[model samples]
Target chain A: MMEKYHIESYCRIKDQRISLNGATVFESAETNFLPFIKEAYKTLDTQYPKFFKMDALSKLALIASDLLLKNMTEKNIALVLSNRAASLDTDRRHQQSIEEADHYYPSPAVFVYTLPNICLGEISIKHRLFSENGFFVFEQFRADPLVDYADGLLKMQRAEKVLCGWMDLDNEKYDAFLYVVAKNGIFTHSKKKINQLYQTS
Target chain B: MNKVYLSYNNIVSGYGFDTAAAVEGIKKEDACLRQIHDKHLLPNHYCASKVASETLEEAYAQLRPKEAHTHLEKMLLVSLEKTIRASQLELTDRVGLIISTTKGNIDVLEPENPFPKSRAYLGQLGEKIRHFFGFQNEALVLSNACVSGVLAIAIAKRFILQGTYDEVFVVGGDLVTKFILSGFNAFQALSDEPCRPYDKNRSGINIGEVGTSVLVTKKTTHLAEESVVLLGEASCNDANHISGPSRTGEGLYRSIVAALAQSELNAGNIDCISAHGTATLFNDEMEAIAFNRSGLQNTPMNSLKGYFGHTLGASGLLETIIGMHSLHQNTLFASKGFQELGVSEPLNIIKKTTPKPIETFLKTASGFGGCNTAAIFKKVAEK
Candidate 1:
């Protein structure tokens, strides 16, 4: 028989607004990407100095994961995140560094984040998760596949918990809807529930 | 446990176009690394293996003439075309497609690129392959750094065990581009000549490009002559650093331990080891420590990077295909460009091509973001 999983917790950040379990946690009309993300990081009140060096996408994912994973201390967590742009925000910067032949100088710091999965690495480093993690790039927000993959991991005993969702950033526009999937929660693990949580803007 | 078999594999690399050509090339001890001197591509002449433009176009045209595709797409189509034909399996709803790549068509992001910017997204590349093949299910794109290739296989096996799909086709590839070249150059990880893995005087890596495809299915009735059963697999992140590997080789060591435990096999049972072996100083040392810790120090191991030059996401799958050939032919190929023992611990590195009754082998890969994957394969028994 197939095992059933549930959503233990959820968090979303659209633009500068933050929410947890469909309730608004913080809202700001700030349209600038840097200030908005910085303020959100400040609100967390944690001393993670490495947060400043991360790209916008990693920052967004780190913040969302920090909130959803609060008070949870499980090391066997798997990360399954997807996006539409897929590091294009950083790719452009890396591209600009070598766009001109006379002044070509690409920074290694920017080049490291060109792959979308680096954000997952950041989260794993912060939380000490050495479990299964995969990063998928989609044309849009895909709910069914996300649910199926996360559930499959849990069902196969590959992971005790899963941190999965859609986190995308491009051109100062960002949206992240991250949730924790575990063996206990109120909402049953299903595509419909995942879609509802993703759409609760 | 549900049995999973990887068969009907195909490869498109600098050596040749099909699996037969690649296997033959390896058997004949041919190194595909070529010295390239294009200023726009690299600052200095570098040894790398890249499929010629005309050859890619011709192979792609034979597969899909009317449809226009990117270079990466062309390589994938040509490779998958052969695998799909050999399998002769219908594209029913039970079949799935999984593409493994780190940067798909990233050259399109160049200022002078002709293609649209959207082509840079890996998902767009997946869509091209999916629509061209007319796969019944949505395609899965795994882009978790360098382990993306082998990790795709693990994911495909899980999907089958979970009863989601009966068969999954995995294709992995990456192309040599200025973007990739510049990035590696920034880290001073590019080698001027062919890379030498585990050599005391080894330098950095040489970036190569290739596309490889393999069909994973549960039904053994359609298994090819070279088919090997997937025994067990495991993936673990070091949780140490995003760019640098762990000095302790903790993640890879743990992965090997878990995979061996799951397969119910001991290190003594593994006939050979196909290591990641990027030829870099840190990577080779890290792998050495991991293998030593896992008690695989006595296993005959070789790194194919001397010929393939670290194909990134495609390296794991490409090297695994070579391992499949190794098990079938019972021949152990020499680790090209390896002159002497480099790392601290002693490993029985294969220095000469020798024939042996190979039965089981392990394929391991470690990549950026401190990700490592270990998979065990055993040759199938006759009925």
Candidate 2:
């Protein structure tokens, strides 16, 4: 059995505000996530020039995971994500290529991200987590299975620490939440203490 | 970690909404194939068995007004409505929601003139469902190819044991569209005749659509006592092929062995198996090898694709729900279109309806991208 881990950092994208650290970073969904990413990168004081301009969803996940990675070492970190739509932007592009019969078929580059789990692949490459990875989608977001999946990974010793949450971007309303979980003695973060971290908010 | 039981499960497939209806239709051994006569779509290239109208209409009538209009929306909303209502749960209750699907709202992406935006689709369908129920804690979605539904259940069990959420609602669904149909056609995997899983003359798969929901909880209430409990589950990447399963069934074998180990049960303990018989040659052959390697060769197994065609993402939950229904009813539905053994490895596939005391069962699926999952369920004594 794996020991329970509490959610330390909680963030929500609502009414154009990225609520985290008991403060509102941005007030518009269109621009809020990018600033949130910039702020996260600023906190870490490390910047990846390649990720400076990418899809908002991928950038958001990268910055968020960077913040999560700061809390602990990168040993045995896993990335698991859930989404209602896989990559709508990429899908839209692929659909366009397919529709344009006269032109060449869509490149595999764009076609690959059309699958939802590709984001996990992106996060894995960014974090260097070559271990266990998976993506699940349903009509709506649910937590029981995600928690169960994370715990299973821990119990199986597949990953010592996991970055798990939901990252969804379709039209304009993009939202993502993530938490880090590890063994009892592997890190200093306490499940109970972490629960209190959210209490002040 | 405490063991979280899968209390109640149900589905709305082409055959019907509930298990009784699906099983009854299966017992009759009816093939619900229909001709592709719609002028808007290609003709004669594709055919499928669809769920009856009454079942869907009845499901629609029961849904809340806000959830009943759209096609994909209605499929998910109605299934969840019945799932919650059957479980006797309040919408405000603290529970996790796990939605599993592949190509959700892909139909919304149609109309080539102006491409539809994905965010609007998510808000109208995905967020709408969350806000409708007020699930304030955590709502996650899983879209891992075709194994999404089965993976959803495995994740729910993990969360409950870790004490993330007391309960979870696992919903899986997808609507059929020209986009998917054409894609499958491109892959050359659609069978004109009714699909025959493990048959010597097996063709390809008949793509179908379905929606299924199961309420899983850690609380062992009386209702749970009367339901099937999920014992164990495991998932493994073939790492062998992207579009096809390994001929040796390496990943599938590992997944089955892991699941059996997690449940602390040997191969002999399993009473039956719900094979992922997509009717494709490579898929059936690989699954047969995996079963043989896992010592499940003799277990009476069957595939429900003959009854509902291939529901893709919903197949995992839909099949598991049907498996639970078999335990409760003590009647094993035969593989609808099975005739002769096809694969090299021999499997004991049920040809006729059989009544036996089913204590435990296994449900397995293999999808594109080298993904495979196996789940174990145990029948419990009704309290």
Candidate 3:
């Protein structure tokens, strides 16, 4: 049987309320990846130095995941992310190694970021989420699967709460959206209720 | 729960995208290995395996959106085109698009240009694909490591079962870039020769690129006779290491067990297993241990990496599609380039070609971040 889970809190970096829950905490199309990271970092009460450069997706995932970790303990939370670009920064660095024939050596540090789920690693290390963590990438973001995965995690009682979302970074733009899903009796959705939510959304 | 039927699946790889064509190539048993005669490219490396003809850039060029798109965009377009064509479904129909890839447009970053402030390029890829096909439903991207393709299919099945969308399109693709090649090379993970899975002489993995897509829908909708049904799937992380598998294969064992339990099938029920035979020593040994732990040691298994090299993110679906074709055609494929057993535990690696009434198949993959996934598929009876 599929487990029942509810969205505890949600955050988005889009311009409109695209979520079925009709919860729009933040909306912005003007903010770049760095500003968005800064905004999320500000909420986490973390200082972001200007020189601390990393991949946009990594920065976005770290900051957003930090916000999710801020309210809850880091013991059991699992980070599951879906995005289009796994790690663009590492990809660029690797490409440069080939383009420049003379100084062609791929950095293992940069190459490690090539995997899509590395953000989960970054988040886990920062928050000490030593539980389950994985990443999934697809052509686009489908809400049903996202919901199902969260529901599965909760149903299996793998974690008390799961932080899942779509975080994709490319070029000058980054979009990071996340929601915390839990099995609390107060906030829960049945299969029928989930269907209705999508129908109404 | 509603029954979800996996409909059409297609792949555009070095061996050719059409199912019949690829199957023929597979039957011919041609190894896609070439000796590096050109000293100019790299002198010391004696052997380097690559996808047949056409580099990733060339394949992207064939898609014809020469100017506006990046490598990821072009790959998506090609994969979507084949998938959409195979499904014969209207793009405007209320269906979801689930894309799986490792590195998206990360190749867009350059030293001189660096990543821009907006990072809009990533979002634009999804939005543009959605716009191009006019999909009314949501578009999702799954970016897990090598297991991403299978994970996408698993997610699509859940959505269809939960009635979130009547139909879902699952696409997985990745491109070979100098970044990945050089990185794998740096780690000494790249096999100088064609990958030899489960072979005593096996060295490491040879990187390859591929794109594959599948259409899944609720069971209420009738599909053609060739459509395959995804029975069950499970994914779990070892939390053991960031870049290697758990020697005990704890996460992998759990995932396989969960998947089998979800499908309500025992270890003996699976006719064949598609191992994530990257030919890497640790990966093969870990998989062997996991298979043994799952009590699937007797299952006839093979790895398609020798034919296509390690397709990273695309392998999950690419190999799944191959397994589906094998089941449909009733021919068990040989584990290409398997001459000797490398692991301590003896695995029933399919060497010579054989025929079996394959009603069910199991596909599994493990990646760098201790991620493991197993998906089971059963042959659908013709109505």
Candidate 4:
């Protein structure tokens, strides 16, 4: 028998809009992810200046995770996030930096974010969550694995809560959907409910 | 809950197409990292253990793979087929496949490459591996930096324990690409000479390439000649820095503690350790602190980096495969290229290939995401 878990909260950031629990919290029509995410960061009224130094992918993950984890009391929240690009956005930049010997200058600042899971690091640092942290890459958003893995963590007591997410960025197109699962919450955690919430954005 | 065993495995790397060749080279103290002057592989000279095209093609040709595959796909398929054939199992829906790589087909993104840019997407790479093998489930691609290989095993164990799949085929690899080379070079983390992990005068990492595979199943009958039952595994974040390790080794210490707790063992029980010694200043120092904090400063440990030159995504799994052999052989392989202790912690770094009675060992990996994973494996008694 599987243990019962529930989705405590969910958030989506796409098309310059931030929605939480099916309600809009922030919106921007800047048409560019850079300017739009900047507005979203300001909407939070947060001052973690490190956010600005991050790549677009990390910024998106940080803000989406921030919204759901801000008022949470649980300390052992494990993060299991998946994405499609897998840091290609920053990989391209790093590749271009040393592409030509004449103009070779690769900055460690940009090189560090080449891995997809660095956002997990940022979120872990921000929340002081030292629990299990994982990052996976999928062709498209799939909720079944996320639900199954997170549920297992809770069932095995690896973590009291799990923050499952799908955050992807490629060629200026990106979408982020994050949800927290706990023992008690609003909706029962299931693949069906997760997919519906992802679409509800 | 079901007990999971890492039964069948293979390691295809620069040493050769088989795991035995690698272990043999290590025992003989052969130079694993070599000088590569290939213009096609890279413009500058590199000290890496990259599988030559002829070596991979000759082995891959034996498989008669049809469609044109990238270098990485070839490496992965060659390694995957070895384990699949050794296991002699059906690839039904009960089986799951996981492809772990930090940057799969990343060279496709370079202008010098001819493959379609679509190959650079990690999903497309996963698709290639899955389609070649006809895995029942959509392949799971784990791309977490450095830790992906070991973490994939932990996930495979959870999958079986959760009744999600009966078996999982985990294949992990990463190329020594200009992309990664230049990136590490930018951080000034790439060593010009062969890496000397934990040596007093150590330099930095020698980026290498390898494709490794292992089967995780609940049945002991499927165990290979050299196999071990997984006792426990856990991953934790430092919550410290994304790129840098914690000064206190917090994440790694907690990971070992949690894993030991799960394994029902204490620090004193671990016979050996296969560490993630990338040979960087901070990484080695950090591991020293973490092992010291966990009361494992005196454990017989070796970093196989000198033997494999840090195979990135495959390093953890490749090293784990070697550790499985170490347990079976009752031998402790030398921590090659180590002369004196470098870190502040007192470590019993293996200095020579000595025969030792061992049963259990810990495999640990920490990566750029501040992600750390610790997995404990123990030998099964003879039937």
lDDT tens digits by residue: candidate 4, B221-340: 858878898999999999999899989989999999999999999999999999999999899999999999999998999999987898888888899999999999999999998999
In model 1, state the lDDT of residue B238: 94
* Reference-based lDDT, each prediction: 0.89, 0.70, 0.70, 0.90
Model 4: fnat (fraction of native contacts): 0.86
Q: Give iRMSD, candidate 3.
A: 3.9
Give the alpha carbon lDDT tens digit for every residue of B1-383 in model 3: 56777777666666665556666778778765554544334324634444444455665566666346655555566767777876678765558887676765544444443445223234455566776667886567666788887877887886665556778888776665555666787778877788899999997877676667778887445475567778888877775655777888876897899899988999999999988999989899999999999999989999988888887777898888889888888888999889989998868999987887889999999886677889999988856
Model 2 compared with the native: what TM-score?
A: 0.77
Give the lDDT of residue B221 in candidate 1.
92
Tell me candidate 2's TM-score on chain B.
0.93
Output the lDDT of residue B347, model 2.
Answer: 97
Kindly report, for each predicted structure in the order presented, the TM-score of its chain A compared with the true chain A: 0.97, 0.73, 0.76, 0.97
Which sections of candidate 3 miss by over 4 Å? A1-78, A82-86, A94-98, A122-160, A166-179, A185-201, B35-79, B105-122, B220-222
For model 4 the local lDDT of residue B245 reads 92
Q: lDDT per residue, candidate 2, B290-310, as tens digits?
A: 999999999999998888888
Residue pairs in collision within model 4? none
Clashes of 1: 0
Model 1 Cα lDDT, one tens digit per residue, A1-201: 677899988999996799988888777878898788888888876456899999999999998898877678788898999998888899989988888888799999999999899999888888888877789988889997788888888876788999999999988989999999999997998899888878765
Fnat of every candidate, listed in order: 0.73, 0.23, 0.45, 0.86
DockQ value of candidate 1: 0.80
lDDT of 4 at B197: 95
Could you tell me the lDDT of residue B175 within candidate 1?
93
CA lDDT of A52 in candidate 2? 64
lDDT of 1 by residue, B33-111 (tens): 8888988876777778898889888888777456678888899899998899999999999998999999989999888
The TM-score of candidate 4 is 0.98
